[model samples]
Target: MILLDAGTTYAKILNTETNEKTVKKVAELEKTFKADIGTGHNINRFAKQSVNEIIALSYAGKRLIKEKSFTLLDVGSRDAKYVIFENGNFIHSDWNTECGAFTGQAIEILGSYLNLNYNAIEPQKEFITATCGLLGMGHVFDMVASSVEPGIAAARLIKGVCMSMYRFARKPHKIYLTGGLVNNALFVKSMPVETICLDRFTLLEGVLEYAASKKDDINL
Candidate 1:
């Protein structure tokens, strides 16, 4: 079986039989290459079976996280979402599309434009009032124009972005974090709350898990 978590910019693919995983640009995936089970924005276009990203995350959270009560947040290319669980049971979930506009994309483009290495940027105390990625990026540009070092400006933007995500997740004491940002050290460090970064493949794992469970009832 194959599973895919295809986001706006990239696709995380998993071969269940081999337990091998690969990340590829969404544009590079052939139209004919479909997954047995899949989730994410672009998955519907190529997946034989589709699952809601949030539902996939819930399955992953229950399988991966050991905490009885916790918050799991998946900040993807286009948006941010979080699920709250109490005593191992999901209680609430929220997906922030409006204010989270182009968050991951913003970071990627800004880093490329600035030639900034997120792993090297230290989390800073001073951050712009991002409110959202677009507004935050505006602040970054203004700051850079004012002679703020490009790296510093970028760091501030990342911190602001992290803060926005934190606030949206209701500022949990500790977050179970996943998605593209998990690999960005600065983004992880900038998170105002304690954060546990999960593998970027977390969502793919969820898709695989769901496919396994439904194999007996559904043809795949």
Candidate 2:
């Protein structure tokens, strides 16, 4: 089975066999297929196309995993999403569209300001008390402008992001963290639950898992 996680910046694909799983960037596959897929475009359209490719490759069958009881938190470039799943199907999800500070764009902006790559920042040592993304960004910028070390600043930003996510979670269940920011150790550590940071193939895995389970049903 093939899993596809399509994001605003990049897409990940996971090929899962009985014993092993292989992961790669969707862009690499696009290169092989000679397609134009990149960031800053229509993500939904790209996502559908990417899933279709994975489905065709699997041949075994393709399914989009839609768990009804699981809450999937996807922190993407432009927004943060809180998705609810129940009975192995998606119920509903919420997105923080008005606040861009908690999204990947803020992270990128901070990275640029500090002249540090995203990976260079260290894990957070303190917890953030900010309630909203915009307020959090203001606090972060003030802290950064005061000559705070980039690592700690990054950590604090990550902490704020996690805290924002925690607020939106209505029930206790396994929390899945996906998207670009999942690479931050501080953010993952601050999660209230035993968070699973599927940094590599989260979305793709979801797609493949969904496809496999719904093959017989064929309504997905």
Candidate 3:
């Protein structure tokens, strides 16, 4: 079975039969390409079977996390969502589409605009009051205007974005972090709490889990 986790900016795909995993821009996927099971914003356009992104996240977290009490946070290109599990049961979950706008994308744009490499940037001690990424860019500009090193200013903005997601996840003591931002070294370093970065294909794993649950009936 082919599974997809198609987000606004990128798609993570997996072929269950071959264990091959790949990432592609959403625009680059051919109209003829389709997944047997999938989740995310563009999934509806390309998937024969669709699942709620949050439901996919929950399944992946439950299957991969052995902790009885933990928070699973998935930060993507545009937004962020989290699921809380306690005593091995789902307790609370939230998806913040509004406040999380342009999360990973903003950081990427900032890096590109400044010709900065996030891998070489270090997390900053001070951060701007970036309630959201777009708003954070304004703050970053203000700092740059004040003669703060562009690299330092960018790191601070990235830290603030990280904090925003950390707070959204209810300031968990430790987080099982997933999604695109997990690949950002500075973002990972900026996390205020212990962060366990999961595979970027976590949501795709959830798609597979959902498919497996119906395996007998679906004949996967």
Writing each residue's lDDT as its tens digit, candidate 1 over 1-220 gives 8888999889999887899989999999998998887899998898888988898898888888888898999998788888989998889899987654788888988898888888988889887766667777888999999999988998988888888888888878999999999999999999998899999899987776776777786578
Score candidate 1 by lDDT.
0.87
Candidate 2 residue-wise lDDT, 184-218, digit = tens: 55567767677776554455544545455566754
lDDT of each: 0.87, 0.54, 0.88
Model 2, position 52: C-alpha lDDT score: 37
Ranking 1 against 3 by lDDT, winner:
3
Off by over 4 Å in 2: 1-4, 14-70, 85-92, 98-102, 116-138, 171-174, 213-220
TM-score of each candidate?
Answer: 0.95, 0.61, 0.95
Candidate 3: where are CA atoms >4 Å away?
Answer: 216-220
- RMSD, candidate 3, Å: 1.4
| Candidates arranged by lDDT, highest first | 3, 1, 2
Best by lDDT: 3
